[model samples]
Structures are given as C-alpha cells and as structure tokens.
Target chain A: MTELDRVIHEPARLRIVALLAGVEEADFLWLLRESALTKGNLSSHVARLEEAGYVAVEKSFRGKIPLTLLRLTDAGRSAFGGYKRAMKAVLGKG
Target chain B: MATDAQLRDLEQRPQRYWNADGIPELVMGLVWIIWGVALLVGEALPPGRGQQGYWMVMPAILVLSGFGANWLIKRLKERLTYPRAGFVTYREPGRSARLLSAGVAILTAATLAFLIVTGRQGGTEQSAAPAIGLILSLAFLVAALRQRAPHYLALAGVALMLGLAFGALRLGWDAINWMLVLLGAAAALLGAWRLARFRRCNPPSVEHHP
Candidate 1:
C-alpha cells in the first residue's frame, strides 16, 4: 500500500475520504453534519490530508450562501484502492 | 462495485468554491462613503453647530475609518483564515446583479431619509456621522449574515458602528470621533496579524463549477 493509503486508514478521515470518494464533491456542512464531527476536528484532519496531497477543498457561494466542498486526490484514490486490497488480503478473501 | 468506483472517483478531484471577502469589503466601503455624504448633508442642515466648523471633522473621521479598514484588510490578507467555501453551480449569483441592487437600495433609502429628516432638522445640527456610520455598518452586517459568510468584516463593522454610535450618544461628539480612530487602529492591527497568518499558509485553489 502507498503512503497515501496509510493516511486514509484513520477511521474519521477514512470516512471522509469514503464519503468524498462516492460523491463528486461533498458540501462541508453536509459532511460535518453527516460525519458528526466538529468543525475543528474535520478541519484539522482535512488540512493534514490536503497538505499531504490526498484531498482538495473548494470554496464558493451558492447565491449569497458560502459553501465548502471537499474531494480526494488521484494519489488518494490509488492509496484507498491499496487499502481495500490490503484489507481484503488480510481477511484472506483475495 | 460501480457505486464504489464512483465514490472513489469523486474523492480525487478538485471542486469550485467562492470567497466572499472581496464583496463584503466592497459593500462596506460603498456604504461608508454614502454615510459620510449623509453626515456632511446632515451637518449642513443642522439646528446647532452649523458654522461651528467642528462638525466637519465627523465626515473626515468616517472617511478615514472606512478607507482605513478596507486598506488594512487588503494589506493583511495573508494573516487571516478567511472563509472560502464551495457552492454548487446553480447556487452562484448572477454576475454582480445582487450587489448592484443592494447598493441602489441602500443609497436610495439613506438619501431619502437624510433629506426628509434633516429638512425639518431641529436637533443640534448634531453630527449625522454616528447615525450614518451605524446605517452603513449595518448594511455590511446584514450582507454578511445573509450570505452566511465570514464574520470578521461584519464584526468589525458592528464594533465600529457601536463604538461611534454609543460614544456619540452618551459621551458627546468629540468622544465619538476619537472612538472611531481607536477602533480603526485596533481593526488595522488585528487585520495585520491575521494577514500574517494567512501568508504562512497558502490557501488551496478552489475549482469553478459550471
């Protein structure tokens, strides 16, 4: 598994990555509410991962309302795949 | 599964987002100018202090404070963690339309109010500075709250308005001007610190959707 894969192993970040991995982009509020994580918690994790080039954050407005959207990186994708494979291998299912 | 792959793909790309910092400042500055003009007119039509020449200082203070706030914020952009959030493509405002409308509304109301009230004008040709500043600052506050944007600019506006209004109403005109100066200085200093912090961390480039 790659270094990017290892970072996503954290449960909360993994969940974040998992959520973003599924949708084109997830609104920050939605993610925070859905993930049940505080702003600071999510931000710190996202910041670390983003700095590591595993995720991207976007900021814009919807009408007058500000929105934040988060997405993963290509490296993140590769790592996530490896993580899945490693998990499967450990489970003796692959 | 196909769904799993889709989710993974979604995570890997950048998305577009918006930053409201510029718009708020722009609105705040415009409103400040309007308030200054109103104060000048109000001072002109006053019942007292009409050629006292002391009232002239109010508009000067307003102009200086408003411009100073804007300048400080712009210069200190590097220190603050200004909020930048993403909106869906359908959510973006029509190019500059809402802003224009808001500006027109504010100007019209302020102008009408100044003309109608000051015309009868029995009070101590009191510096309209406090009232005008309050209204203008409130405009920024309303915009910031409505937009669900960052609070720094709005907070600064509120603080200035409150300081000036309360100071003028209670302590007297001289106190209000000095209060504004102090408030401006504080905002400038805080903005500088935030800008310094912002500079240390390069913000992520937001993507444009649609």
Candidate 2:
C-alpha cells in the first residue's frame, strides 16, 4: 500500500475525509451529524486530517455562533482515489 | 500530525467552483435575438386590428422578460457569499406531471395562434382559445400541486393569459390591452423581487477559484 493509503486507513480519519470529499465544504456540526461521531472524537480526527494536509479548516462566526468549515484538499482527493483503487485491486474488484 | 510543509502544499491547490457568468450572458443574448425577430415579424406582417399583430407581441414580451430575468440572475451571482454547495438533488416529477405541463404550454401557444389567425376579421365569432387556455392552466396547476413543485410562477402566467383571453373575448380589444399591460407590470415586479433576494442570499467570495 502507498504511504498515503496508510494515512487514510485509520477508521476515524477515513470517515472524516470521505464526508468532506463529497461536499465543497461542510459545517463542523453537519460533519458530526453525518458521521455520527462525538464532538471530541470528530474534532480529534479532524485535527489529525488537517495536520496531514487532507483537510483545510476555516473558523469563523456565523452570526454569534462559531462555525468551522471543513474542505478536502487536493492531496486528500488524490489520496482517497488512490486508496479506493488499491482497495479494489486487493479485493480483485478493480 | 501533518507537517507545516504539507499544509502549505495543500493551500496551493485550485478551488472547484468557478463563476458561471458566461451562461447568463448566452441566455440573455438568445432571448434578445428571439425578441428582435418577433418584433420585426409582427411589424412586417400586416393582419387585422387586434389580430396577428397583437398576438405576435406576446412572444416578444415573453422573450424580453426572459432576457431581463437572465440579466438579473447574472447580477445576483456576483454578490453571492455562501460557500458553494454541490447541486441539490430533488425527486423527479412523475411522467404524467411532465407530460401535462408540456401539453399545456404547447396547447396554450397553439390556441393563441389559432385565435389570432381565425378571429382577425373582428367578427362576433366565439373564440375557444381562452377556454382552452384556462382548462390547460387548471390541469397544470393540478399536476404541479400533486408533485409538490413550485407552481406560483406557472400559476401567475396561466392566470394572466386566461384573464387577457377572457377580457378580449367578453369585454373587447381595449380591455385585453389593459390586461396585458397589468400582466407585464406584475411579471416585472416579481422578477425584480427575486433578483433582490438572490443577491442578498449569495455574497461575493475572494477565495473562490475556477
């Protein structure tokens, strides 16, 4: 497996990247709801992905509420595509 | 943890959402051409008073309205601030609904044409176009309601057309002219309101890339 695949193989990080990849950007609350992850768990995983350059985070205030928007980076997209292909190949479905 | 070097690399990548100003321009240009053609044809072709000439103006007015709408949409796009979302997926309307709407639009245009051609002589002959338009409109309203689609604009269009047709037949040509003017004003007002709402909802973004 490629090094990128290794990074994305973690269950929490994988789910975080997958959700962000499908949208242009998503609110932190939306990601939590969709992934069914606890606030702390989701935040930790998001931080890891953000550190890995798989996601970009924008923190701002929507009215009085603090909003965190997450977007997948180009590297994240390429890595995700590669991981999927590698998985398919391993499963003999590619 | 990812390194600072990685974050810089990620930031260099391009964005996905591109401005779509050209699409509105193309649509507006096409509407203008159609309106120009209709106006020229209406003027060149001589028909009886309140006949073909009058009916031809309908297409011209519709095309101009379309042009104005496109222009307004283009202006609104410039001010949209929200982070772009992917296309929203909605349930498709049933086959019956689609067919009914298409049928009504076609029938309404056809009936209007027929009345303009046959009733040009200013005779006392009863025109069926108005009745047909009303029935077609009702059918469309039912279909739109069944599918839970936005039918206000369709409802308004149908109502205006039917009102004009009825006024023309019952009251006379002068009443029909007044009704058309009222419809035009209403449509313009609605279009302006929608444009304003669109602009307010969407704000400009400096970070977006093509």
Candidate 3:
C-alpha cells in the first residue's frame, strides 16, 4: 500500500484538490463556491497547500477586477493520485 | 477516507456547475438550425452550374458552421456565464468519449444513407421518416442523459412523434428537409428559454475575487 501524503490528507485540502483535478484552472471564487468553504477558511487552506507546493496561485487582474487563479501543480496531482490509490487499497481490504 | 466515487463526484461538480447555464445547448441548437437551412438550400438548387457548385458549398458551410458555433459558445459563455459563476476550464473529454462521439456520427450517417438509398427505389419521404425520428430522438435523448436535463427527453419524444407522423403522411421528397428545420427551430427555442431562465435566476457577480 502506498503512503498518503500529509499535505493532502486533511479533509478540506483534499476536497479542494479533488475539485481542482477536474479542471485546468479555476478562479478563486469558483473554488470557494465549489468547495463550500468560507472565504477565510478557503484562503487559509489554499495558503497551506501553496506553502507545500501542492497548489499554485496566481494573483492577477481580469480588466479592473482582481482575479486569483488556482490549479494543482504536477506535484499536487501526483500526491492526489497516490492518495486515491492508497485509499482504494485500504477500502478493498476492508 | 473518502472513496474514489466520492472524490470523482466532487471532481465532477465544477463541470456540472459550468454546464448548469445550458450555454452549450444554445450553441448546439443554433448550429443544427443553420446546418438544416444550408441543406435545404442545397436541395432547392437546380442541378447545373449552381447545384454542382453547391456541393462545394456544403463542405464550406459545414466547416464555417463548426467555427461559428465554437466562437459563439465562447462569446456567449464569457458574456453570460463566466461572471456569474466565476471561471473554470473543463477537461477535454477523454479518448473513450471522443470515440463514442465518432462512432455515433458514423452510425447516424450510415443509417441515413441506407434509408435514403432504399427509399429512392420507392419514395424518399416514406423510407426515411422513421429513421429521422429515431435519429433525432436518440440524439436528444443522449443530450438529456448527459446534461441531466429532462426537457431534452421531452424534446426527443416530440422528435419521435413528428417522425412517425411524417412517415404516415408521406409528404414527399422534401418532407425530411422540413422536419429537420422544425427540429432545429424547436431545439433553438428550448435552448433560448433555458438560457433566459438561467439568466433570470443568476445575476452577475458583484464581488471581485480575492
């Protein structure tokens, strides 16, 4: 059985990364809504993932509006994939 | 620990959100209507300089319609959907989905060709009628299932009924052409209605992203 990465084991971050896995990139607001996380909660979880190099954040402007874009880095994708396999392995035994 | 299906469902949420507005339906409906009209025009032209030339036009029309539909969807989404919902880029469909689409296209084309060729021996309208209904309804049914929109199933039922009526009446060679036009128009109308409803419910965002 593969070991799960600590960065993605937390439920909130897990949900965030799982949602991001479906798309190429999503704006910050989109992630917040989809994750059903409060603005502050989402921000901190995103920050923690960012610190671990599991998520990449780009702050930019779309016209005058400040836009924050989010996507999983390659490392993040690998970690998520590993996490999924480990969980599946455990589930199969159970 | 969340199961794979749970995570997969979570992954699918963003895609479902993007599609909730039914912008793709509007694009698809318009494309169908335009293509139907172009085919009708081809059938109308007399066989000679214009008709021979029109064969060339059919390919061009198909190509142009593809480009136009692609552009229209992006423009419509940017203006109507993106702001209200925020931005998400869906993953391109995987190989199996692409293969399924291609298979459907080929099957439809083959079936239509068979019907037309066989009908030419008797009557074009009579033979093609049931196939038209089957094809149209199936197309709509697939759309309904994929989009999880029940209205498409209703549309499919309508298409099926119209096809049977057309076959029973045997309205002649041009009957299927008119049916196609009606199908296109009906699709466009339904899509527009859905789009209007979507707009009414979800106003544009007032907040800038953090």
Candidate 4:
C-alpha cells in the first residue's frame, strides 16, 4: 500500500495545493477566495507548505499595498501528482 | 479530505480565472471593429493596380492588433483583476492543445488563402464575408467548448448567423461591415458586464499582512 504525502494529507492544505497546481502562481486573496479559509489559517498552512519546500512564497508590493504570491514548487507539483495517483489507486479507480 | 467534486472544481480554477476578467473578449471586439473599418475603407476606395499597396494595411492592422491587444490586456489586468482577485499567472495548456492550435492555424490560413484567390478570380464582394464569418465562428466555438464558456457559444451562433446572411443571402458589402460592427459592440458590452460582475463577486482583500 502506498502511503499519502502527509504534508498534503490535510484537507485544507490538500485543497490549497490542488488549486495552486492548476496555475503557475496565485496571490493570497485568490487562494482565500478559492479555499474559503480564514486569513490566519490560510497563512499558517501556506507557511507550512513553504517550509516543506513544496511551495514558494514571494512578497512584493503592487503600488503601496503588499502582495503575497504563492506558487507550487517543482517538488510540490511532483508531490501533488503522486498524491492524486495514490488516491486513485486507493479508490480502486487507477 | 476534499471530495472528488471539490478537487475537480479546484482543477478548473485557472480556467475560470482566465475568463473572469473578460479582457480577451474586449480585445477581440476591438480587433473586429478595426477589421471592419479596414474592409469598409477598401470598399469605398477600391485599390487600383498601382495603389494596391493600400490593401497592405489590412495585414498591418491584424499584426498590430495582435501585439497591441496583448499589451493592453496585460495592463488592464494589472489594474482591473490583480487587485481584487490577487493576481494569478496561469500555465499554458498541454502539448495536445498546442498541436491542436497549430493545426487550426494552418487550416485557417489555407482557407483564407483559398477564399482570397477565389474572390479575386470571381470579382465578388460576397466571398470575404463568409470566409471571415466561418473563421470567427470556429474560433469562438473552439474557445467556448474548450473553456466551457457559454458566452462564447452565443458569439459563435451570432457569427454563424452573420456568415449565412452574407454568404447565402448574398448581402451587400456594407451589410457585412455593419454586422461586424454590431458584433464588436455586443462583445464590448458582454465584456463590460462580465467585468462588473467579477468585481462585485471578488472584492479586493483589505489586509496587507506578510
């Protein structure tokens, strides 16, 4: 039996990673809108994903306002792909 | 754990984002308007043998519209969509999509060349309208189906109708120009409506926390 990626196993994080996988990069508000996670909760999960080297976070300013952009790293993409395969296999649908 | 439906929705987020702003449609509308103007001008002042160089402006309009619209759309996105949705850079589609796009481009070129050659030989104004209409319909249909965008389907229907009116009914040249102008107006309105709705749905986030 193949084990799931623990980092992406959590429901909220799984959703976040899945959303990020579809785009090259997304900003914090886009993630918030899509994931429906609270500001603090979303931030923490993004930080954890960043720490695991699965995501890259960049801080920049659009005008005077700060913008936080998040992207799935190569590792993140690979992990997400693996996670999907594992899920499908476990569901007996692979 | 996310449900299967939830994951599928997540996978489609980028496609939604790409269409959300409606900038592409607006740009396309402007391009059509320009082409209509070019066609009308060519009709009003028929290019003579020595002055056939005037017809070259048609291709120039196309090339410039492509580059200019891209730049304008980027700037518009920066102002309109970036603040509210927080910007997202989308990835290109897979290899199969690219190959399909190339195939379509080749087919369109061949079809357009055939129409132009046939029209010149026949000395008919009607030939160009159907060709343009067919191309527009195919482009809209492809985009609509691929993106699951119902609005584009409406555009495709309109394009087909206009094509039939021009080709089958043998409508005059001015009628084709007028129809294209009307389509451009409709596209602009659609884009504006979608842009307003997108803004209302996704208000800009207030927090600037890093």
What's the best-to-worst order under TM-score?
3, 4, 2, 1
> Alpha-carbon error at A67 in model 4, in Å?
1.2
TM-score of each: 0.34, 0.38, 0.88, 0.87
Give the TM-score (vs. native) of candidate 3: 0.88
Expressed as tens digits, the lDDT of each residue in B105-151 for candidate 2 is 79877976776567666653344435444654565466445433343
Candidate 4: segments with Cα more than 4 A from true spot: B1-5, B49-51, B92-100, B119-135, B172-179, B208-210
Predicted structure 3: clash tally = 0
Worst 10 residues of 2 chain B by lDDT: B12-21
Clashes of each: 29, 7, 0, 0
TM-score of the first chain alone, every candidate: 0.86, 0.92, 0.93, 0.97
DockQ-derived CAPRI band for the predicted complex in model 1: incorrect
lDDT of 1 by residue, B1-210 (tens): 223444443343322112322432433434444454545455456576664565677658666766676665444332232222222222234669899977997987788477547634745324444654565467547655545445456454756566566645654343334444444444445444543444455353343222
**Native A-B contacts reproduced, model 3:** 0.70
**Which lDDT tens digits does candidate 3 get at residues A1-94?**
5567888988999999999998988898788777888989899999999999989999988887778889999999988888888887777742
Per-residue error at A46 for model 4, in Å?
0.9
What value does the lDDT take at residue B46 in candidate 1?
Answer: 51
Task: Report the C-alpha lDDT of model 4 over B12-73, residue by residue, as the tens digit.
Answer: 88887778878878877877788777777777775586347767667787778878988988
Which segments of model 1 are wrong by more than 4 Å?
Answer: A1-94, B1-99, B102-120, B124-137, B153-183, B203-210
Interface RMSD values, listed in order for every candidate: 9.8, 13.0, 1.4, 1.6
Q: Score candidate 3 by DockQ.
A: 0.69
DockQ of each: 0.08, 0.07, 0.69, 0.70
